[model samples]
Target: MQRKNSILRSSKRGGFAMIMAIILIVVLTTIMALTLSLTSQTTKQTSDLYLREQAVLLAKSAAELALLKVSGWNRATSGCLTSVNAVYPSTTNKIFDINVTMKYIGLGCGGSADYIPAIVTPESNGTVLMDVTVTSDPGVSTEPIRYFRRTLQKL
Candidate 1:
């Protein structure tokens, strides 16, 4: 009778051990899944930040080029200043092209606002204003990481 009781006890202990092993496996699997998900999220955020930085740099370069054109015109002693045009380099990883245009204001005393040039005029007044457009590459679905638009008038 004692031997039979010992055998029953051994079987109960084995069943308990099997249950614990199953539970441990489940817990480990869950932890691994969470870790992978976190890693993926971190990678995606890094890519977005890098792309945004590039876009800002591209835009600034375009603005500088436009300003150069304006200054160049003023330095020229003679010749009726007209419109200015400029283009910027292409961006990679779905960035955009920068375009700038400036029109010279004519007729200092033209009372009609319609007669005023579309762009800021340094000749009529000392202030020159420019319009800048940074357009994303065609068919690029990525949302612009950043967008900046301003009218700058300088003497």
Candidate 2:
């Protein structure tokens, strides 16, 4: 009887060990899968953030270019320099679309009434209201990114 009882007890222990091993394997697999999923999501988020930052930088550069253009504008010309649009890099493969819109305030530039009242501020002479928009084109970017910047610059 003792021998038989020992044999039964050993068999039960082996079965329990097998079951525990299977559960442990399942838990480890789940953890690994979750980790892989998180890693992929992090990669995508990082990519998106990088693209957005690039767009913002491009917008800022476009704003500066707009300022330069306005400063060079012939003030004697009755028409205010209103809009400018160009693409960055100018390569065969275009990357970003930049659009700059300017509104002027005070004298010399068309009485300033040609600009919308909401855009022009009173007593702000020689101020160039620069609105810059930079958009990532579909040719290279995985997703479309657009950044807009408004600047008040003294000409």
Candidate 3:
């Protein structure tokens, strides 16, 4: 009788251990799945952030370039280059499209420029408003990224 009781107790303990093991495996598997999901989400967010930062930087640089063009322009000699458009790399795998438009304030660009001064005020004369827009190419970027920067420069 003693030997039989011992055997029964041992069988019960073995069954309990197997149940515990299964529970532990299920918990661990759940944790692993959650971790993988979070990791993929983080990667996608990082990629989007990087792309947006690039677009913002490109817009800023484009604004500066527009300012440079305005500074070098001789109003008396020729019409101002009111608008500029070009791809960043000018390559087949182009990633960025930058567009810049300019408006003169305070001066009458009357017939002198293809872009007439949008705002003509005595106080704002010799001032320029440059709008620069940068967009990630749809062909390359999975997520759309667009950035616009406006600069008011006194020339």
Give candidate 1 regions above 4 Å deviation.
1-9, 73-94, 101-126, 131-146, 151-155
Q: Write the per-residue lDDT of candidate 1 for residues 62-87, one digit (tens) a residue.
A: 66766666667544454423333333
Every model's TM-score:
0.59, 0.73, 0.78
TM-score, model 1 to reference: 0.59
Model 2 has how many clashing residue pairs? 0
lDDT of each: 0.56, 0.78, 0.79
Model 2: worst 10 consecutive residues (lDDT sum): 111-120
Task: Summarize candidate 2's per-residue lDDT along 1-155 as a digit string, tens digits.
Answer: 35455666676888899999999999999999999999988898898898788888888887888788777777675467888898877857777889998876664455443443333555566677788888888865567888888888876
Task: Give the winner by lDDT.
Answer: 3
How many angstroms is residue 60 displaced in model 2 relative to the true structure, after the best TM-score fit?
1.4
Candidate 3, residues 1-155, lDDT tens digits: the string is 45455666676898899999999999999999999999998998998898889888888888888788888888777756678787877767788999998877755666534234555445666787788888888876567888888888787
lDDT of 2 at 90: 89
Q: In candidate 2, list every pair of residues with a backbone clash.
A: none
Worst 10 residues of 1 by lDDT: 106-115
Question: How many backbone clashes does every candidate have?
Answer: 0, 0, 0
